[model samples]
Target: MKSLVSSEIVEPYAQALMSVAKTHNLADRFGDEVRALVSALEGSADLSQFLANPFIKVADKKAVLQRIVGDESHPFLRNFLMLLVDKGRILFIEGIGKQYLALLRELNQTVLAEVVSAVELNDAQKESVKQRVQNITGARSVDLQTTIDPDLIGGVIIKVGSQIIDASLRGQLRRIGVRLAA
Candidate 1:
């Protein structure tokens, strides 16, 4: 699904990033780097403030990013960050990360299925569940985001994209238990 980020504003940057990523075959890599940068910015109030500083030159901010995230960050990521800093739009890095993921999901035709269970599934079991989801969704591929929630009581609550399949005992019990309690 398209994100809330305006394509008119983001397309230019996304196109630029996409070209560089295609050249390096690192679209996903660049996205990961963007995410890391976003995390770093969010984790440090001082750093975020520094980036958002109106007086800071774009070159200086770029230098700061290079110093922090290091040279391994893809060139596109470096430029993208610098561009935002230059334009005084640094605060939107978090939104950019979210938009980047949305773009990645679109390009890959992949959807995230959140699997919340009472306990962690073994690797094999997780793969099995993924396969089942693929079969049901008719999606050639699926990305599973798994989490362990002890309060689930049992079974799994499969979130197929934006929808949820809450079969957890806590959920069912809440429905029936409510009837009984009433």
Candidate 2:
């Protein structure tokens, strides 16, 4: 969790790996490999012990990791694991995996736009809404991820990055509530 909190430190490494993965047409594979590796590290007590056992050599740890994850593991994962072994951040493998996946998702032409509303959108409505997001973000295309929250009352909230377009009746009610409470 500490490593996750230090995400700013990992972004550049993740981005560089993502760039190489994209260049090799292996982004999806690399992401999957990282996920699998993290899962293994989390699920196996033996692996964790072996990784952090100070008495064990780093070369031994690398060999064990290779055997477990296999030669088929993505180059990014291999390089990342080796780096952790070198720098003694093997404990943060999960953090690196997560950061890499996040970077990969962002680098792909995919942007997660959460459109919250009082009701679900029909197919046509969803497509049109996603198109609008793409237009605003200047992304190649927008893959619209939808959420229906009845509490929103009326109107829509469009969120991309740190920006949000909230035009909801519930939001207005909240403003009214705040004003009255004040």
Candidate 3:
């Protein structure tokens, strides 16, 4: 699902950061590092709050992040964090991270596919689903993330990027109801 934070706000920051990473030949590395940072922030509410709090000094927050990431961290990533601090964008890091990953996936010719099945998909079922998604979307590959939703009753719902293919029994029933009403 798309983030509530507007792409207007998120994309520019991600694009600028992607440019820097590309210039350094470190797009994949920086992407991984940013994912780690987002994971860390998500794992700790206090740390996230510390970075996002408007009353706190940006320098102090940068110092804390630097200490946590250590001296061995990539200079580009360190500087990127500092840039975020300077621009007062530290709080939007999660959205930035999402955009960064999305950019990376697009660069790699992979589409993120979210699948919800009435029952957990087996390996063969998963491969079939992925192949169908690939054929439909014309993506070179599908990065499939699956969830089980018993309320669906049967079949699966597929979401690739913003497009959804709803074949679940519940969805079928809804369509039938609409047709009957019409």
- Best of the two (2, 3) by TM-score: 3
Candidates, ranked, lDDT: 3, 2, 1
Report every candidate's CA lDDT.
0.76, 0.78, 0.87
Using Cα atoms with residue i matched to residue i, what is each candidate's TM-score against the true structure? 0.71, 0.53, 0.74
Model 3, position 162: C-alpha lDDT score: 83
Model 3 error, position 156 (Å): 2.6
Candidate 3: where is the Cα deviation over 4 Å?
1-8, 39-47, 67-73, 118-126, 145-150, 179-182
1-182, model 1: which lDDT tens digit per residue? 24545555565666666677777788889767876766777679898888768787778877887798788876667777777777766656666666676577667777778899999899997898889888888776787778899998898999986778888999998889889999
Stronger candidate by lDDT (1 vs 3): 3
lDDT of 2 at 160: 86
lDDT digits (tens) for residues 117-148 of candidate 2: 89988898789878888888888766555788
Model 1 residue 1 CA deviation (Å) reads 20
Candidate 3 least-lDDT 10 residues: 1-10
Better of 1 and 2 by TM-score: 1
